[model samples]
Target: MIADSEIELHASRLMVMQAAWKHERGEDIRHESSICKVFVAEAVNRIIDRAVQMCGALGVSADTPLEHFYREARAFRIYDGPSEVHRMVIARDVLRSGNRS
Candidate 1:
């Protein structure tokens, strides 16, 4: 699970960076932005959780870096915009595109 989450998070970061560069070059990348946001937001939590699970008691300890990551990842889900909203936006865009084609 940890490996999968790491892979997913990396992919999301790459997507976001690419989108940002595209926007800097005067391209519209709203869909990529939302997709990356949702992907990273969800994957970060999963990675932390898997790490926590692997660490056992130490994972939940107040002094551990894993715990801090866990908290941050959980809170990140709600920052800027929630995962639910981003997913909805992506779904709506997909539906619109499907209808067009």
Candidate 2:
């Protein structure tokens, strides 16, 4: 779970950097940020869920920090951008790229 979350975090940072670079190169980045944030949040949430499940009841007990982690993970999904919004950005980007051919 840690590995998955780390990978997601790295991917998100890379996407953000790519968007900024594209903006600097005169390409539109309005969608990239939205997509990146959504993907990252989703990935992290999944990872956290798995981690919580693996830890069993302790993962949710107040005696452990996992509960706090779980709460933060749930909250993150609502921030930046939601999963649906990101999916739309990705779909639009794909359609616009004309790579479907």
| Best-matching candidate per TM-score | 1
lDDT of each: 0.83, 0.76
Cα error of candidate 1 at position 27, Å: 1.0
Query: For model 1, what is the C-alpha lDDT against the true structure?
Result: 0.83
Q: How well does candidate 1 score on lDDT at residue 90?
A: 85
**Lowest summed-lDDT stretch of 10 residues in model 2?**
76-85
CA shift at 67, candidate 1, in angstroms? 1.0
True-structure lDDT of candidate 2: 0.76
Per-residue alpha-carbon lDDT of candidate 2 for residues 1-101, written as tens digits (9 for 90 to 100) = 67776787788788778888988999867777777677767777787787788889987889878788778878776766667767787788789987722
**lDDT string, candidate 1, 41-92, tens digits:** 8878888898899889989998579998887779888987998999898899
Q: Give the distance in Å from residue 49's predicted Cα in candidate 2 to where it truly belongs.
A: 1.5
Cα lDDT for residue 44, candidate 1 = 80
Residue pairs with backbone atoms closer than 3 Å in model 2 (clashes)? none
Following a full C-alpha superposition, what root-mean-square deviation does model 2 have from the true structure? 3.1
